[model samples]
Target: MKKKKMISVLLTAVMAAGVLSACSTGQSSTQNGDNAPNTSAGGVTTIEFWAAPNPTQQAFWQTMAKDYEAVNSKVKVNVSAMKESPTSEAGIQAAIAAKSAPTMSENINRGFAAQLSDSKALVPLDTLDGFQDIVKSRSMTNTIEPWRFADSHQYVLPIYSNAMLFGWRLDTLKELGYSEPPKTYSEILELTKKLKAKYGDKKFLWAKADLADPTAWKRWFDFYMLYDAASNGNKFIEGDKFTGVDKAGLDVLTFVDSLRKENGLLARQVTDPFENGVGTFVDVGPWTFTTWAEKYPELKYNVNYTLTMPPVPDDVDPADSKTFADTKGLVIYASATKEQQAAAVDFIKWVYSDAKNDAAWFEQTMLPPARDDLTSNEAFTSILDQHPELKPYAENVPNAIPPMDNAKYNDLQTIIGEQAFNKVVKGGITPDAGWANMKKAIESALK
Candidate 1:
């Protein structure tokens, strides 16, 4: 009851203290390339692109086409997309059955990139002309950051990324006399309790726990990464050469289980969570832009959100609080011919690396830019200006750990979510036993 009032007062006070950030909740940025229908010239090399209509993706292809076409008048590009293949095998199947698939295509970023990596169907992007300089200096730094690694060499062109931190309702925390948000993992637990206890009679609540949404998985991935940011940290995805999983990582995972404990301290929308305030803070991505925020504008004044990262342990280095990164890259299709590659790269590079659309883009589509450069662009300025607290997730890119991965990506998260849910939510297993069950299921599934 007190925490809610404190948060509310703090939220209001923050405005006087200069609380200017975007109030806009963001939509999930998809491979939503701005691919539009284009006519090709006979003498020009035409690259066929098959993708879904991503009305809200960052670095839209259509915008890129205008610039690429302006320079490569001799090269032509054609793009078409269907809906519903996002998590389905249809895209791959369609490619397999096609007379000839698009010379260039959009991938699932990680999973699809992995597929392309496995099938050897994609061109080595680093070999493309002018790629070395762009990747080595600008693109890799400005774009992919640490995500620029390839298993063998440089095979992917990373365009954008995502990370997890924390977001809580400032209004809900005001009753507790808190003026700022928590910065460490242990602090998050304490703050969670504070909010739960503070908001007694107020319409505002603090902190919702995320569960089972693919959009929310970045936080789950980040929680474990808080302990270690290295590629194979926590052994979430074991490579043949590395052996590392620490107690800190286990604690984070267990904490996640704790979020959904049946005693009901946590929040999940199994039946529309945000609607009921099951838990105010949720580990989520931009999807909340449409799901929760747009529908309830008043909620913005009540809740303040930011990315959820590992808080600095009382005894540990604050830098170590950062962990886990979600890499979203652009994958060029292998079937794209030598000639098509020329135009494709030009188009992709221009939008991802150059075009500025925070206002024209996000405002029109209700989405957020994946580019670090545009986080506070005019379209999103109102948001960043008011909610300066979002900086943790926005700024933690450098220390981000990688998103979850397994041979069968879907099956992996499904198993983890199930094991943890069964143990913590269903009362069927202990946390340790649940983790053991997760490891066993993962190993068996791998085999």
Candidate 2:
């Protein structure tokens, strides 16, 4: 699971899908809190929680909020739903711009969290009780450095992580003579080629690209994970800094171009694994699996897909097959009342620590848990244990990294993708020329 995301393009898609597509809730234009006193007349705390606009998620979240409210009648929690489909992220910006934001919401990335943190929009949770313990548990088992999340204070908490793993038809692989997933990039390419030759028109594409920036960018990042992270001084982050666009960046884009232009082993930008069935192997996450499992049950049995880490570079450590995980978490807003914020924290903690809370979420959703103790919880172990092919891909998780978050990085990537990536892959220019153009565009953006 390598890290890549196209936020701007996707944001616009959201706009087309209508501002109301993801979730249906009331509209408010400011960070309004509980102006009303408690029923006891002692004190009242109210906060608004903005989150992914998924309708399925609404039930679980609202239930949790209601429970919290029951315990603290003085504390009111309004969980506003905004669909991410058409333009959910925009609502965040729009609400903030209109000065009508909720008390708590989190729209984060490893690189972008700082922007919000610096603006004082997010509260520091470092001083909260059980925060350090939660950090330790998450760090050791998940292999994520908790300190990596630290800003001036604790702006974001570690949430469930998602990664891009190889999904394939298990029976098809065996029919093609690959008893297991390949261990290297070249191996997979070779395997896919053999399968392509056998299937002829029925292809086992490595991946498909989407105009949506995140989907397109993730396809690129997952390809990079097939290489060595430190082979030629590759490191996504150095201490508290982002370190992309060196040999790793070059090697990443080079491989991507090679995959599309040279190999032709991947499906095109518009192929959907669910609708078209044009591809065999696809890159996706757990949520995608859940969607497929539910929305298209007829295709479920056909999807014997599993996870495998991106291959190690030829010269690098064989054991270091890391995954690129870009997932979401909960962050309280600075505007939230202390009691309301505490209530939010309590809801979050219960999910991470209590079995009942964990069960409710798992029953409601198919998310991977953030804590290891909870991995044994029925959600992961059952399906994963039965599907061993998913094991190899699961190895990449501990090493997951977030994609670049700098605003300049975003603009530079867009320019490079438009000028170099799309052009080279679609055969508009020579690879060398495309590389040079990308380099120039990025440098200009930096300046």
- Per-prediction TM-score, please? 0.71, 0.73
- What would you estimate as the lDDT of candidate 2? 0.52
Largest lDDT belongs to which candidate?
A: 2
The global C-alpha lDDT for each of the candidates, from Candidate 1 onward, is 0.47, 0.52
* Candidate 1 similarity to native, TM-score: 0.71
Q: Model 1 segments beyond 4 Å from truth?
A: 1-42, 57-59, 83-89, 136-139, 142-150, 192-235, 238-244, 257-264, 267-278, 290-293, 301-315, 323-327, 352-393, 402-406, 425-427
lDDT of 2 by residue, 1-447 (tens): 122334542234444233332112222322243343231235765567775566656677788788777765766677768545434555564444344556666445544454444445556777666666655644334434532543335556645555445466566677778767665556656776777678765654554654223333543344334333433324343324544445555554555565564354453565464234556566566656555657755454324544565555444454665555655556765545466567667656654554565445544555543444444445455545654433333344455654444433355546656666566556566656766776666566655
Candidate 2 stretches greater than 4 Å from native: 1-41, 72-74, 83-86, 106-115, 127-130, 133-153, 196-204, 207-242, 253-262, 266-278, 294-304, 337-343, 373-397, 419-424, 427-440, 443-447
**Candidate 2 structure, TM-score to reference:** 0.73
- Candidate 1's C-alpha lDDT? 0.47
